[model samples]
Target: MIKVLFFAKYRELLGLGQMTVELHSTTTVADLKNRLVKEGGDHWAQALLADNTLCAVNQTIAHDGDAIADGDEVAFYPPVTGG
Candidate 1:
């Protein structure tokens, strides 16, 4: 299983901080996002697809095409800003 985490506004929008997902060995970050969209529907779209959301794999920034493996931890959040 892959551990998925949502941070910042994404957590609030999705109403979830974390979840475990079972995915195929060939799954990529894009695939995971698609699956989330399918499962969570509009709420997922709003939180993930609506903006330039950032992602990290095992605490390192990752792109949509990045590979994902079992036991990996993936996190999503909006871009950070400061004054």
Candidate 2:
């Protein structure tokens, strides 16, 4: 299972901080996002599909093509800005 975590605004919007999903070993970050969108419906689409949304795999920033496997931790959060 892949552990998915939502942070900041996303956590609030989704109403959950984390979840576990079963995915193939070859799944990529984009694939995982797509699955989440499908499962969570419009709410997830709005939060995850936004252009500014960012992703991390196992605590390191990652891109769409990054490979994911069992026991991996994936996190999604929006960019932060402060003065």
Candidate 3:
């Protein structure tokens, strides 16, 4: 299982801070997002697919094509802004 974390607005959108998902096979970050959206429906789709939504794997920035492995920790959050 891979651990998925939701932060800030994502937590609000998904109503959970974290969840464990079973990986069926080799998968990428985008693949996981698609699966979550497919399973969780509209709200999940909005949270995960929002423009500029940031993702990290094992605490390092991750891209949509980055492969996710069993036991990896993945986080999703909105882009930060400050002046």
Query: Every model's Cα RMSD, please?
Result: 1.3, 1.3, 1.3
- Against the hidden reference, what TM-scores do the models get? 0.92, 0.93, 0.94
lDDT of each prediction vs. the true structure?
0.90, 0.92, 0.94
Query: lDDT value for candidate 3?
Result: 0.94
In candidate 1, position 45 carries an lDDT of 90
lDDT of 2 by residue, 3-79 (tens): 89999999999999999998766799999999889977999998899999999999999999999989999999999
Q: Candidate 3 residues 1-83, lDDT tens each?
A: 99999999889988999999998887999999999999999999889999889999999999999999999999999997758
lDDT of 1 by residue, 1-83 (tens): 98999988999998899999987676888888998999889989987775599999999999999999999999999998868
Please give the RMSD of candidate 2 to the true structure. 1.3
Error of 3 at 30 (Å): 0.5
After TM-score superposition, what is the CA distance of residue 42 in candidate 1 from its true location, in Å?
A: 0.5
Q: Could you give me the TM-score of model 2 versus the true structure?
A: 0.93
Over all chains combined, what TM-score does candidate 3 have? 0.94
lDDT of 2 at 57: 97
Task: Please list the residue runs of candidate 1 whose C-alpha ends up more than 4 Å from where it truly belongs after superposition.
Answer: none
- Preferred candidate (TM-score higher): 1 or 2: 2
Ranking of candidates on TM-score, top first = 3, 2, 1
